[model samples]
Target: MKQIRNFCVIAHIDHGKSTLSDRLLEYTKTIADREMQDQALDNMDLERERGITIKSHAIQMYYDRPSDGKQYTFNLIDTPGHVDFSYEVSRSIAACEGALLLVDASQGIQAQTISNLYLAIDHDLEIIPILNKVDMESAMIDEVSDQIIDLIGCEKEDIVLASGKTGLGVPDIMEAIVERIPAPEGDPGAPLQALIFDSVFNAYRGVIAYFRILNGTMRKGDLVRFVNTGKEYEADEIGVLKMTQHPKDKLEAGNVGYIITGIKESKEIKVGDTITTVERPCEKAIQGFEDVKPMVFAGIFPLDNDDFEDLRDSLEKLQLNDASLVFEPETSAALGFGFRCGFLGMLHLEIVQERLYREFDMDVITTVPNVSYNLMDKSGEEYTVRTPSELPEQHTIEMVEEPYITAQIITKPEFIGTIMTLCMEKRGTLTKQHYLTPERVELSFDLPLAEIVFDFYDRLKSVSRGYASFDYQPIEYRETDLVKLDIRLNGEPVDALSALVHRSKAEAFGRQICKKLKELLPRQQFVIAIQAAVGAKVIARETISALRKDVTAKCYGGDITRKRKLLEKQKAGKRRMRQFGKVEVPQKAFLDVLKL
Candidate 1:
């Protein structure tokens, strides 16, 4: 067990963590030369196309230490760099003993880098700082090195300078992993207590759970049970993770591996649940990382309503792979059967939407994302509101509270004014401002989660010229003047278009949605009254004029009385049509309003 090293790579997005991981695999000869590829660990097609790691990947490698001339087992988990996938990172961290804190030499320290570093620290994991991309022309090695030193308070000589592209300084990193990072500690003779860090569904083989044995040992054909689910199954297969599964008869304490029990149901296996032998069960299930809290909520419905069950099955399988994704069955008046999915952020939501389409071959419609709100009704009862339609009627509400987040932004000093203005516009309160260096500044603000769910990140990047790195966590909910804005077409409400917005911006937001609907809604025979209303009062309105036939054009030689009579008849027809004519809202309009 002392000869084993379990560690993971952590970094900000695009900081070369995956690339460095590839080089590590090569240096360790885990993958043959021909099999080597960019972001090799990122196996998902969506991940490769987007040039990001959406999931954490684990693989085992054998490294021969030259100093001791001994073979060492290395369990390497490559984690995602984005904030939305931080839950994956945390799970990975819990299963490992150390982390490689990779920093982009050219970009220096970033918001996610700092955020991930704190997670590592909280886990009591050993941190090995690696300054990557040092070979690039824009690499600011000295500056970034100093920043890392100031942040972690490590010595200058301890920082490893490497380039993931050219495979430079990789040998030193491998040596550091063996020398600096501690090996896992557990009792092989004790009752089996394995922590199920992650799992994935397989069409042919059933469910494969990847776990790290904290105590005792697990062997092939052993009868095991999930502590949380209380379901028992024989271990059909047990293996260590490689480029492919390498079947093994037994996995000892301090080792990371996979177990297949032929459990076909996705819900039967839960990530973070403890797995132990039915014969010698552990005393208790391993308490894994904290529960994932979703920051954004949206409704997902199938384009073809008949695919609802398929969508549900797909989500269950997907959730097995991504434990952070949470969803519950919901219905909308306009969209019919769907689910209210809770996502970590917009990118997470988009990735899930894309994955459903690509992996499951299911067409889906995602409603505009919103943050959940808390409310107290006239009866003094508290309720959680996920959708605008869920908000109690205006007269029945006593208080509305929205989730606020403490956002940490790191950027150049010149954009400070614009960033402050942007946060203020979002009804944010500035909390702290500190200079990491003369050129770089870190600003902290408390902003509503709803405000940043839309386009706050994009705008922050644009205003900061892509120099700002943003990270946020939900804080306490506070009372606010929030209104449920409804979009009514011809006196009928479209529930999907309704949103809960801050009272101050309600009118302006309503006006914006009304204008957008006017532009996107197709013209009908009757004039469509696109009205944005609050309660019984209409705050904004736009009219889509009816398509008129040349009824007056045919009466060019008629008297003025005849023309008037024809116009009045046509108007009466339009009024009657308005009562029964249903407006066919284009799918594009529902998606486009999100941009507003």
Candidate 2:
């Protein structure tokens, strides 16, 4: 255990975490020369295509210490840098004893860097500050070094200046990992207590759970039990994770590896569950592991209604891999039977939708995304509303409280004016502002979660010219004047098209949706009335004219009364059709409204 070092590489997005990981792997000779690739730990195709690490990948490396000429075992976990996947980072941190806090030389310290640093501190993990991209022409080495000192309060010489692309300072980083990071402390002879941090599903091998052993040793063919499910199974295989799974007879405490129990059902293995021997189980399960809190809610419905069961199964298997995703069955008048799904953000939702299509061959339609709300009725009964259609009647509701977040934005000083204007337009109140340096500024705000759900990030990037980094955390639910805005086709309301919005912006928002619907909805035999309403009042309206058949074209040579009679008959027919005619809304219409 003294020679074992377990740590992870954490940083903001595109701050050279993966690149540095690649350099380290090469330096340690973990992969062969021909097998090397960019972002080598990111095995998923989607992750490579998007240039982001969507999943946390763990691998074992062997390094030789120069001082004592002793071989050491290093377990390195590479984590995603995006704010949406912070849960993955937390899980990785929980399984490690230290972290490499990488900062970009050009970008300095951003919002996500600060947030992830706090997570490491909360876990009591040792922090190693490293400055990456020092070889770039625009690298602000001195300024960024000072910023890192201010952030972590470490000495000047303790920070490692490295260039991931050029492979500079790679040996120094390895030496620091061996010297600075503390070894894992556990009793190998005690009862086995392993924390399952992540797992994956395979058709041929069944479910493979990746865990960190904290107490005792686990051997192959041992009778093991999952504490959460209370089910026992013989360990089919035990192995360490390299580029591939290297089968082994035993893995001792203070190491990371995988175990296969031949459990076919995905639901049987939970991500945060504990694993132990059936004969001598641990006294208690691990604590401080919290459930994932989804920031956005949307309905995921199958393109074909009969594929509902298939969708459910697909989601179940997907959930096993993505522990953050949550869903329950629901039905919509406009879209039919579907499941209301919760996601960390819009990008996470899109990635899940894309994965379902590619991995499971399940094509799905996702409704407009919205945040959950807390509602109180006149009788003092409170309800948690996820979808707009789930809101109670207007009169019966007493007060509505919406979730708010503390938004932290780090950007250049020159763009502060435009960024402040954008936030104010989104109904955000400025809470605090300070300068990290003369060139870099950090602004904090109290904003409703719903306000930033759609296009706030995109607009922030545009306004700051891609120089801004943003991060947020949920604060509390506050009372607000919220109204349910409904879209009516002809006279009936479409439950899927309803939304809960602030009263101040309801009228303008409704008008925008009404206009977008007018362009997307097709014309029918009768004129279609599209109205956006709040309770009994219609705030916006749009009409699509009918495709007339020219019923009076042949009566031009006859008496004026004949033409009048024909026109009257046509008008009556149209009125009757308008009352009973149903408007067919295309799938594009539901998705297009979110663009507004």
Candidate 3:
């Protein structure tokens, strides 16, 4: 146990965490020199292309320290860097005794860096602050070290300097892992208790669960069962990830490994569930494990109706690996039958959408991401709406509440005014601000989740000149004067083009959406009336004129009365067609409204 160290690497998005993991794998010889690649832990193609980590990967390495000439078992779990995957980092942290708090020397502290540090602290895991990217000419190791000292209340010397890109200080990092981070604490003689931090589905191997054995030993032939599910399965194989899965005889206390159960369904082995021997099941399950609830909702529809079942199967398979993803059947007049899916955040939704197309080869159309809203009626009825189309009329609703978030943005002092203006336009209220350095500032605000779910992030990046980093946490739902703005085409409501807006800006929002719709919707033979309405009253209107033709162009010598009659006849035909014609709205129209 003393020689065994279980730890995970955590950091903000794109803070060289993946780069550090790659170097660590190389340092431990987990992968051969020929097999090494950039961001090796991010095995998914989308992950590599996007330069992000979407999954947590675990690897086992044997390091022999020269000082003691003793071999130590190192379980290094690489965590996702994006905030959407924070749940992955949380579970990885829970399954480890320490965390490698890697931060970029060039970027200093970021929005997610603070959040991840606090999560590790809350889990009571030892955090080893390491300054990375120090090999770059632009790196400011001295200044970054000072920020670390101020944040963690440690001396400058306590901060470790490393560069994953150049492989500098890699050896020191490994030695620090052995010397600074404590090994797992548990008795081998105690009842079998293991924490199933992650699980995956393999068509050939059935469900494979990766866990840290907290107590006792799990052998290859043991009969294991999940304490939460009470379903027993024969443990067919015990293995560890050495770049790839390598079979092992047994996983003992203070060690991390994977178990291959005969259970074919991945859902049978839940993340955060305890694994114990069925013959001698643990008397009590581990505490503090709770189910994950999705924080964002979006509608996903297949581009072709024939692919509906395929999309569903894809979502089910994805949910097996990602338990946080939730979905149910949904239908839309504009998009057709689809699923309303719930996700951890916007990035999660984007990844899932991309995977649906890339992995499954299914063409999908995703609606605008929306947050849950709590609504009340005059009759004291309560309801929750996940999309703008689900919102009720203003007259029937007695009170309206929206989910707000505690947002933090870190940027240069010069960009504070631009950021503040952007936030104010989104109806954000200033909470507090702190000057981190003479040239940098940290601004905090309470912003509605709806306001930022769309293009707010992109706008923030633009206004800050790509120098700002932002993060948010959901706050309580509060009462507000809100109204549902619905778009009607030719006196018929289009539920796909609806939004919930504040009463003060409802008219402006209506006008803006109407204008965008005009550009997106295709012109027809008959003029289409596009109106943005609040219940029965229309607040904004835009017209797509019918295609006009010169009716008298061929009649050069005709009477003036005959030409006028010909024009009048043409106008009457258009009026009749406008009343009865069915307009075809292109898919781009729905997308334009979502982007708006």
TM-score winner among the candidates? 1
Q: Tens digits of per-residue lDDT for model 3 on 125-147?
A: 88899999998898988888888
Best by lDDT: 1
Candidate 1 global Cα RMSD? 1.5
Model 3 lDDT at residue 117? 89
**TM-score for candidate 3, residues paired by index:** 0.94
TM-score (C-alpha) between model 1 and the true structure? 0.97
lDDT of 2 by residue, 467-516 (tens): 99999999999998888899999978988788888999899989998899
Please, what is the TM-score per model?
A: 0.97, 0.97, 0.94
Write the number of the candidate with greater lDDT, choosing between 2 and 3: 2
Clashes of each: 0, 0, 0
Candidate 2 residue 467 C-alpha distance from true site, Å: 1.4
Per-residue alpha-carbon lDDT of model 1 for 1-596, expressed as tens digits? Answer: 99999999999999999999999999999999998889999999999999999999999999998999999999999999888899999999999999999999999999999999999999999999999999999999999999999999999999999999999999999999999999889999999999999999999999899999999999999999999999999999999999999999999999999999999999898889999999999998898867889999999999878999999999999999999999999999888899999999999999999999999998888887899888999999998999988887899999988889999999999999999999999999999999999989999999999999988999999999999999998879999998889999999999988998888898999999999999998888888899998899999999999898647888888579999999999989888988988887877887777656
In model 1, what are the clashing residue pairs, if there are any?
Answer: none
User: Ten-residue segment with the worst summed lDDT in candidate 2?
Assistant: 587-596
- Cα RMSD of predicted structure 3: 2.2
